[model samples]
Target: MKTKLLLLSAISALMFVSSCSSDDDTITPSIPELEALELSNCSSGIAEGETLILENRNNGVDYIINCTYPVNGDLIIDPGVTIQFGTDATIRVYNSGSIQALGTAQNKVVFTGEDKVPGSWKGLYIISSDVKNKIEYATIEYAGAVGDDGAILLWSDTHLKMNNTNITNSQTYGLHANTNNNELILENNTITACKAPMYLDASYVSAISNGSYTGNNTDAIIVDRGFIDEDHTWTKLNVPYHFPNGVDVVAGGNLTVMPGVIMKFGQDSRLFINEGASGPKPSIIAVGTAAEPIVFTSIDNVMSAWRGIYFDSPNALNEIGFATIENASNPDQEGAIETWYGTVLNVHDVTFKDIQNCAIHQYKFPADPDTLTRSNLTYINVANAFCQN
Candidate 1:
């Protein structure tokens, strides 16, 4: 009887040990101390002329901060706060200090308009401050201006770094820059449907332009008289599109359209240069390459599409080469490109095909030097109806 009792006690002890081991394997240790340090309800609404810091709590609860404030100083917004926009709402980072918005790729913070349209409200405006800012993986849409550039209005010395941000469908211009030596480092951003995607101007005609403005836009990238000292160089920024129906530039100011740049047209969409508008007359010096010629076609059924490209300069001496100008018209005088407004043109090897008006048109200018010079349309072949007026 004693041996049987001892055996039963040994078996019970073994069973208890097995139960303890199983429990240890299944249970997870708690991290209460680390979890206690998370923020909670960090400022629901911000007041006007106030500076604040915002962060999302560690408990996976995002803050829906819907307030438009006029900042007195700097507003430091950390990662994780998903800032939603209300009706006609806007946040102005005033001229007092600056705004530090640092967001990551995977878990980024957003500040967008109420309706996710192209020109919703006025976007984040930074005025007269030494800014060191960062905006990554953010979507700024439906934020537009009426008269000026719509989406973003920037002024003074503001250093901004943007990555993978999107600005779409504002009223006038997508992003406006009217400052001196402000560096705008943009990478992999999309700007669409804005009047002018990127607008650059300067106070007192700037000396050294130190801003890096390069992104994909649906409209023309307009630059005002900011190019004073620095090599006023502009590049054609293109986005990936399946059926490329792209933007056109009708100059509103005195401008220079560079060569070796790609000016692609949408399905049946062409560029128009009218006779003597208000702001400024642009000089397009487009010289495309032989193998990779500058293409102009319609955005829809491209086979038999139609558009127009009119270069109405009183005095234009245009240089041509490896370039294709489709859907253009001839001037009202005898064929031998002449103009009243004297235009400086230098043309080389180029092609004019399938145009609505003239393959090569130069009419008499009303200006002083009313003749075209240094132009080479030698190897150009034009199909369809092209006028040489």
Candidate 2:
């Protein structure tokens, strides 16, 4: 009887295993193996005319790269394509390369790391200046390893139009432009889950468009130490522009700050608007609407956190309206603005909030607020002190 029971138990166990195997086969279909693109460290990239199409060939992985992949020619990727990376694996788009990864809303192109965590691999690096280097409707995650500063690093003189891309899970910035010379066109993109949304030169502040720069570890754009040395308009973005260092509007600089634009300056930093003897006069036209006023304040929201704006230009185009200047003016100064001789500043409807002394500090001695504005200037928590001769 014991022998018969043991045989029955073995048969039952075998039947149960067979049922589970049939259910697994029904649930998960057989998928082809992914095409492995074994790339060594800085391998010789693709040449021209030979296109590399990264398609969704297997179960969630189309192409798996072992190391850093270089694109020295045309590299095209279609929708629903998944490109997985190994440790520190990155894709470098070089000067001779052009990548047109056009994905759709429903079927998006994916760039991810094998570990599926932040700092798992190096991110995309675009060093090409090709006009065809564009990427849209894509998702990049688990990038920004220790070797690089950002997940997507754009070198100087590079041109890229990246739209509708979702960048997340980065250990550092989602994007970083090394300098102001790159032609970066960004639109409708969402960058989140990174140290910061981006770190760019002060000259590249206008390259940003309507996108989501918030929802990160720091909801701001790290404006590097640079100057607005050309005529550019800083369009309004959702997050504040955090300036870690001082900036200037030197010769040939005409900066225009649009409505709803927020600028947060570093400690003891100041904005100098000056020009040389014979060049395009430096000017600023910061005209904000009543509904959407512009803001220039301290990054840390501390009292007298920054030095203040200094006007040294004689250009007639210097205009500021419907704005707020706050948390500014160091102990050595007496106002939020320091003006010199021949300076032309047309300021109106501006709310000077949390200022140290007067609203305008005239370098010609005895700071006068009446000399800066015509009317409609409001003050909140201002000391109303005067500068000495």
Candidate 3:
């Protein structure tokens, strides 16, 4: 520190002397500047221990990714470091590699395209399960160049933590988690101006929380076919979840949906609980509060656009309360809620609407079914309140 001060004092003295000699004699001090680093530099060890450390140069973009660059070692990005990706550029962190792009609210790391347009780059892909693979206080934009994955692709079994980030202007889905099972945490992130916000399997939809996925070109979360073979919870995200196909709660699986979750199903969609006769008796616990009821409806508002919830198991754990199930009962299928003989279920405080068939179609029933007389159930524009199949 003392040496720096002395050097500054000497420079000041020289400038003063130069001013006395000739006011126009201006000397620009020379400071060595670091060259821009490319993503290929990180493919091999740029530092000790096979780690690449990128610091903020307090200027323009510090790194350029021009190809499908592979990071073979650990990479650390400091706050306020900007990375400009060229056409078709992508960052692929291998299984042995990890990336930690830590930034602050005041100084966020930026990953953007040189062309300032969507689809200018291929985006980042994380295939590692390293604990250090985290991205926070960052802005990822102008990605989703390919028709495959989105701005960020998380492979199977990878652990990626992304929070407080902004992802915008993607050509396709903002983020894609093509994983069988991955610990991808998303919290307090905002995604907008993209074609679609996200694409992931049903099991990974619970990873999102308090995130803004609306105001995009397509304002819906596209979840893959809901074939959950394990215990999974469908969390209530701000944006509605659209299931283009059916949801099968097969054996060895239990599905639980949180309250206030708006689930939109396409045609021929059905929520089958314990459909197959193997393993344990699975259940669907879709219990919601009356104030914030869970909703299960077809994407189309017409009547009977899809098959409804079906329960084939005799599991006593099946319960559906304070929910709105509508637009169900196909031509060849049963009603909104179907239960065969000996299947145990607890259905109450629910509203059945726009059904082409009975609200609750049981295989055998003694009393005449009517939601008008029932205290716990409500019906609106329904064909039949309940009936024996």
The lDDT of model 2 is 0.84
Model 3: per-residue Cα lDDT over 291-324, one tens digit each: 9999999888888888998888777788899999
Cα RMSDs, all models: 9.1, 7.0, 7.2
Which residue pairs collide in model 2, if any? none
Clash numbers, per candidate: 44, 0, 0
The alpha-carbon lDDT assigned to residue 330 of candidate 1 equals: 30
Against the hidden true structure, what lDDT does model 1 obtain? 0.50
Candidate 1's displacement at residue 144, Å, is 4.1
lDDT of each: 0.50, 0.84, 0.84
Stretches > 4 Å off in candidate 1: 1-51, 58-65, 113-121, 129-133, 141-149, 155-160, 168-183, 192-230, 239-285, 295-319, 329-345, 354-389
Worst 10 residues of 1 by lDDT: 202-211
Better candidate by TM-score, 1 or 3: 3
How far off is residue 41 in model 1, in Å? Answer: 15
